[model samples]
Target: MKRVVITSVGAVTPVGLDAESMWQNVKQGKHGFAPISSFDTSRLKVKNAAEIRNWDPVAMGLNKKEARRMDRYTQFAMAAAKQLIDSAGDLSGIDPYRAGVIVGSGIGGFQSTVTEHAKFLEKGPDRVSVFLIPMMICNMAAGQIAIEYKFRGDNFAPVTACATSAHAIGEAFRKIKDGYLDLCITGGSEGSINEFAVAGFQNMGALTESQDCDRLCIPFDKERSGFVMSEGAGLLLLEEYEHAKARGAQILGEIVGYGATDDAHHITGPDPEGDGAAHAMLHAIREAGIEPGEVGYINAHGTSTPLNEQCETAAIKRAFGEHAYKLAVSSTKSVTGHMLGAAGGVEAIITMKALEEGVLPPTVGYKVPDELCDLDYVTEGARKTEIKYALSNSLGFGGHNASLLLKKFEG
Candidate 1:
């Protein structure tokens, strides 16, 4: 089997526009939550979201015509992809057929769907734009990225709700490890912060009602309410170890193991026993050929929701035994809000950064902890620590669970 290594990473996040900038912001324990400005929220109970402020597609290098035809999520993906490609110097050596793209979005073109549907109701079906269908599908982000970069090998988008991007990255690792491809671009994007999307989530009781930015999205805190909707993109470039080493590529980290499982328990709630999530973690650790104690940090799927935090804590204890207490665990969602499908990709980047830099990001806003979540939550601030292995977990709405184990690149 071939080894898979991350060559470059890029992000379009609420806290920052690029991966390095986001890492710096996270290290300082900064958050991006604010009142919803994308639309009037007077009619809704949820009033705030982590929006990517001052976003200008043209400034990100997309022409007006291209931006108009594509959905906002796709635009975010393209921008992140551009950043990844730019940082990955001299990729022209790899064959196009040996390259691939896998980008996923939980809710793709939601604003487009709402806008065109409103137009159809107001005027007529003919009033709708011609690009509606192509723009609204969840797979267009991957399709557009493939077209942009001309990658021809095994390209597809995974749609596992919040676990979407983790699955994307994990599958990409498999493609390279199994010798199906030499290089791949993988991640997730989301742009569904409009009023309609907010309304749907709020009505479902999945959005935080806290009007205060400081109080909102407090993962693992007893005062936690629900997740705040956020929009952004996170992408990474992965290449075979030999392929990257031959080109003198700057390796960021190595993806050593991945595990995916389904709860089969509920539509929107995790299994109360956390059996599925525990197995996923164990599978990942087992695949990495390392003991649970070797994993020093975990970027939890701590969505700030009561059920998610409690269940994930239980899962961790079940998987790691006594070592669960020895490891540092945090949820960057407390900083970035819930990016939904993009959460996995973004958190993966953060984990890789933490492993490379010897820092563990804190779960900001964590106060009044619950007894159920008794592990070290890293609430005070970012901790300086050297860790060999880091695991990132992403659990989606539909009982989807994915864990990616990354090792600090020693070579």
Candidate 2:
């Protein structure tokens, strides 16, 4: 089997428009949360969200005509893909058949659906957009990315709720590792910060109604509420180890292991005992041929929800034993406000940066820790430490769990 490495990465987060800027802001403990500005939230119980302010697609280099046809989610995906391709340099020598795209979106074109349905209700069925179906489907992000780059190889999107992007990256890694593809664009994007989405989550008691930015999205804290809905995109350019070396590509990190599992216990909650999540982490560590103690950091799927943090902590302890306390663990969601489908992709990039820079990002807004969550959450600030292997976990609503093991590039 061939090895796979991440060559380039791009991010469109609430805090920064690019991966480096986002990393720097995260290292500085800057959060992107604020009162929602995309729409008037007078009717919403949830007041604030981590929104990408001043988002202008045309300014990002997309033509107006192209932007008009896409949902906001697809626009973010295209922008991230452009950044990834630009950073990856010339890939002209790669066969189109050996290149692929696997970008997923948990809630696709939500704004479009709400807008078009309202139009249909008021203006008649004839007023509905012909492009509505193409724009709102969850798979359009992957399709549009493949179309943009002319990739002819395996192209599809995995829709595993919050774990969508992690599954996408894991599947892409396997394709390259098994020699099915030489290169792939993989990650997830989300642009569902609309009133309908917010209302849905809030009504379900899955979103924080906090008006205070500092108190919002406090993962692993005793006062932690539900997640704050956010929007963004994160994409990674992955290539076979030999293929990347042949092209003289700058290898950012190596994906050594991936483990995916399901709880089969709840539709919207993780297993109370975190059995599925624990097994997923163990599987990933075993696949990497590394002991539990070797993992120095974990970008946990700590969603700031009471049940999730407790369960994730249990899973970490179950998987790592005493090592769980020794290793550092933090949640970037406290800064990004839960990007939903994009969370995994964004957190994966953060984990890679932490491994490469030897700086573990802090779980900002963390205070009043819960006794259930006893792990060493780097809460005070970003901590600098040297480490080899790390894990990024993404647990989705359908009990879907994915763990990715990344190693700093030694060669």
TM-score per model over all chains: 0.99, 0.99
Q: Give the per-residue lDDT digits (tens) of candidate 2, residues 269-354.
A: 88999999999999989988889999999999999898999999999989998888999999999888799999899999999999
lDDT of each: 0.93, 0.93
How many pairs of residues collide in model 1? 0
lDDT of 1 by residue, 188-208 (tens): 999999888888888888888
Q: Name model 2 segments beyond 4 Å from true.
A: none
True-structure lDDT of candidate 1: 0.93
